[model samples]
Target: MSELRDTELSAKVKGIEVTVTFPLAHGKPFHAKQAPETTVGTVRSEAMSQFGIQEEANSTYYLTHGGSRVDDGATLASIAGESEAVKFTLVKELVQG
Candidate 1:
């Protein structure tokens, strides 16, 4: 786990705010501001790096929003509705199960 930052991100990342939490990581959650068109896969990848989680052959990491598993291809705009921020939880499980 890493520290959750209250960032004043530059103009390059001014669209929507994103925060991601791990079920059992050490520190705080991952936080950033990203463009509305950013994909869930992108967020997941960055969050993984921030939390120092590695990919595993037997496991698959996924993102969930509002208790429902979110598709990697989905964009922030699709999930955010009329809001300017979004939150997600990161979880890992057996790939074949």
Candidate 2:
């Protein structure tokens, strides 16, 4: 005899800030400020890379675009919000009977 378990995937990425660093043509240490021009997916990839997390097929994150928040079937390419440090909170619950 055995039992079964249930589980789901969901997440929210908040406090997103893309920092760009560069040096002058003269090889001087310098820096610049600019918002990330890439998609949220790319941002996730960047974060994962920063943390040395390999690509896993069982991981996902919730997203909000222009006040429209969705948990599934959305991509960074479709985000319509202005470029800024956007915050998001993810919520998940089991279907009620």
Candidate 3:
């Protein structure tokens, strides 16, 4: 997805849409219209649900945007910046000593 281009999602929210994909999940990308203040953690949880992922014993799920790990506390607005759409890839990180 690209910038809204005058396509208003909501009057109160200049919404930015987020799409998340997992290479190993064997599923389609998860898409959502996110408010500016929505947190990455919240999106991660939603993505997990969409992908039917359950908590694993030693694996952690993280999101990467532009090939960089994104902090859970980061807001979608921050990631999108002047754009209205952002894409993320969900990665499974195994705990390693």
* TM-scores of the models, in the order given: 0.82, 0.32, 0.83
Give the Å error, residue 86, model 3. 0.4
* Cα shift from native, residue 47, model 3 (Å): 0.3
Number of clashing pairs per prediction, in order: 0, 0, 0
Q: What tens-digit string does per-residue lDDT give for candidate 1 at 1-97?
A: 1111223222223588899999779999999988877789999999999999999999999999999999998877777754789999999988774
- State the displacement of the C-alpha of residue 33, model 2, in Å, after optimal TM-score superposition: 5.8
Q: Is candidate 1 or candidate 2 better by TM-score?
A: 1
Task: List runs of model 3 lying over 4 Å from the truth.
Answer: 1-13
| Model 1 bad stretches (over 4 Å) | 1-14
Lowest-lDDT window of 10 residues in candidate 1? 1-10
Ranking by TM-score: 3, 1, 2
Model 3, position 6, has a per-residue lDDT of: 23
- In model 2, the Cα lDDT at residue 3 comes to 14
Better of 1 and 3 by TM-score: 3
lDDT, residue 47, model 1? 99
How does residue 10 of candidate 3 score in lDDT?
A: 32
Clash pairs detected, candidate 3: none
